[model samples]
Target: MNAFSLRRVGLALLAPAIAVVVSVIVTTIVIAAVGSSPGDFWSAMFSNPLPRIRVNVVNQTAMIYTSAVAAAIGFRMGLFNIGLEGQYLMASFAAASFAGAAYVGGFLNVGLSLLIAIAVGAAWAGIAGILRTTRGVSEVISTIMLNAIALTLVGYLVDRYGVHEGNTVRTTKIAAGDMVKGFTPYQARDGQVWALAIIAVLVGVGFWVLLNKTRFGFDLRASGQSESAALASGVNPKRMILVSMMLSGGVAGLIWMPALFGSAGSYGTSFQFGLGFLGIAVALLGRNSPIGMLFGAVLFAYLSAQSNTLTFSTDISPSIVQITQGVAVLAVVISYEVVRRWRARLEQRVVSRELAGAMGATA
Candidate 1:
């Protein structure tokens, strides 16, 4: 890259780097206040002795990356898809019910279930989009309300039709043969990484291409940056909004698949929650690029795997990572906005200088 390109890249990286440093400082402070040795904490956090933890980190990264990509889709179109939590929960439940029904066998089961998930997620998110495009409803409000409705709807479905083995009610269990097969990463002992992780990588690549390498991407981005300009350019902003939401929801549908195929086996009351919200933070921190999102996912995943070990190996609290994450999100948000404003000012100065010189020469 040229000098200007390198400068822009550095500027893009500065905010996330600052956020990470601040989060680290804040996390160390919390650890110190909790009477833990910072040295021991750092040592325990980075020393990945068990191959299993490393595999878990990779698996977790795959899941988190999926969530980030889903969130990023709506973000690119200036839509805040807060309904991701509801969309994924509803999708996973539907997929579990379908796959567990054993209407088909082997690869067909996985394929059909995947389609069901993507469709359900898109349809669920489409509700908000339709409301927005036709009724002038704000997506933020509709999505939040939809989340509540999804929770209630899923609860009712589970209570009425869910298979009960004991006190718990869940969808029927997927057969062992129908489950997605895992492979041994680096041929590690006792490490079987989920095959769905490959799908996650594909999602990221597709997202990148969709945003950067297509006419639809250009129009979507134009619509995102300025609806009026996009309209003047003959791009339908409403259609873009609806499509973006559905697309985001479709990807959100896959967020739970890794966990489902990896270990969860069935959708239950204890299925993972807060992933949608987590995606928002990841998207914000890694706002600029898909690769940045990967780094963010890996960072959080490493903390997750390593910190859990710390709780058992030492007196340090694993929840410290949560504190750090919370702080990091806030820092990232502030830092990025600041950087944006700074860039705008610098651009303004350049434009102003050029205009002044042009006026002088004309005179």
Candidate 2:
């Protein structure tokens, strides 16, 4: 790799490390300030029930990593896909709806249905991309609005077609035969290894390749770095924008698959939309690098799971998890700025030395 590429990788790795260290220090201070014993809190966070804790960790890790990858894809293309929540919700509903439809059948049939669900999600996101490219609408605004619309639409669908055979606002349980197989071990119980984790890792690797090794990836990065320059270089900014949004939505759809096809079983009005928002934080913490995003997702998941265990074992409130996430994001953002400035200085010094050496040789 070139020096620039190596430097970028080094800086990407550094951001998360600095962020984690700062978050830990800040969290400890917050714990003491809140009149909690830091030692006790730390212990509770670390030591917990073996089996249940493992399950929690695995579930949280899977969920966060899925969501983080969704957001990271958009971040790489210079699009902030804040509508991941909406896309995820829509995909989940689509998956559940297809599974419940009597016309749907065999295992291969079920796989095709999931592809349809992912396509639906991509189409929904593509709408925002269209607006942004064609009408000059800001993706941030359009996506946020789309999220509200998606929630309401899904809510209505649940009310109209829910399987409860009553007034409840939730979908019917997906047919067992149609569900994605081997994604979660929780099917038979609360905790076990399933194919979902492996799938998630593979997806992450796939994205890493797409972002780092492909021509499309290069165009996307160019568009992100400078629209004018990308346009000058023969990259179609509008097409890149639209494709990025669609890919991002597809990733979000994958996140929904685990919950809908996995043991979670059904969609409900109680289903929340924070995963998309959390994904933005994850992208920021990861500095939008695929590898960094994976690590960031794991750390965020670990803290979330730790919070659940801490809630039952100690007096600490679960709200601390949110605080920790916020702190981590803040630290990473600041660290990125710091690292950027340092890199600039280093580059300037190198240039100056090269110039000086040239002058000496000429003299």
What TM-score goes with each of the models? 0.91, 0.88
Please, what are the lDDT tens digits per residue for candidate 2 over residues 1-363?
A: 288668878976786689878988988899889988777777877775466556766766676777888888788778889999899889878876777673657676557656876787898899999999999999999999999999899888787778664556577676776665453434445555444556478778888898788999899888999999999999999999999999889878767566556566677754546877877888788777776777778777777777876766788787877888999999989998998898888788878988999999999
Where model 1 places Cα greater than 4 Å from the true spot, the runs are: 1-9, 186-189, 344-363
lDDT of each: 0.87, 0.78
- Tell me how far the alpha carbon of residue 226 in candidate 2 is from the true structure, in angstroms, after superposition: 1.4
Residue 15 in candidate 2, Cα distance off native in Å: 3.8
Residues 1-363, model 1: lDDT tens digits: 265557668778788788878888988888899888988888888785588888988888888889888988888888999999999989999999999999999999998999999999999999999999999899999999999999999999998999887899999999999888688866656577898888789998998898889999999899989999999999999999999999999999999897787777899965988888878778877873699888888887787778877878888878887887889888999988888887778667767987999999999
Which window of ten consecutive residues has the lowest lDDT sum in model 1? 1-10
- Candidate 1 — which pairs collide? none
Indicate the TM-score of model 2.
Answer: 0.88
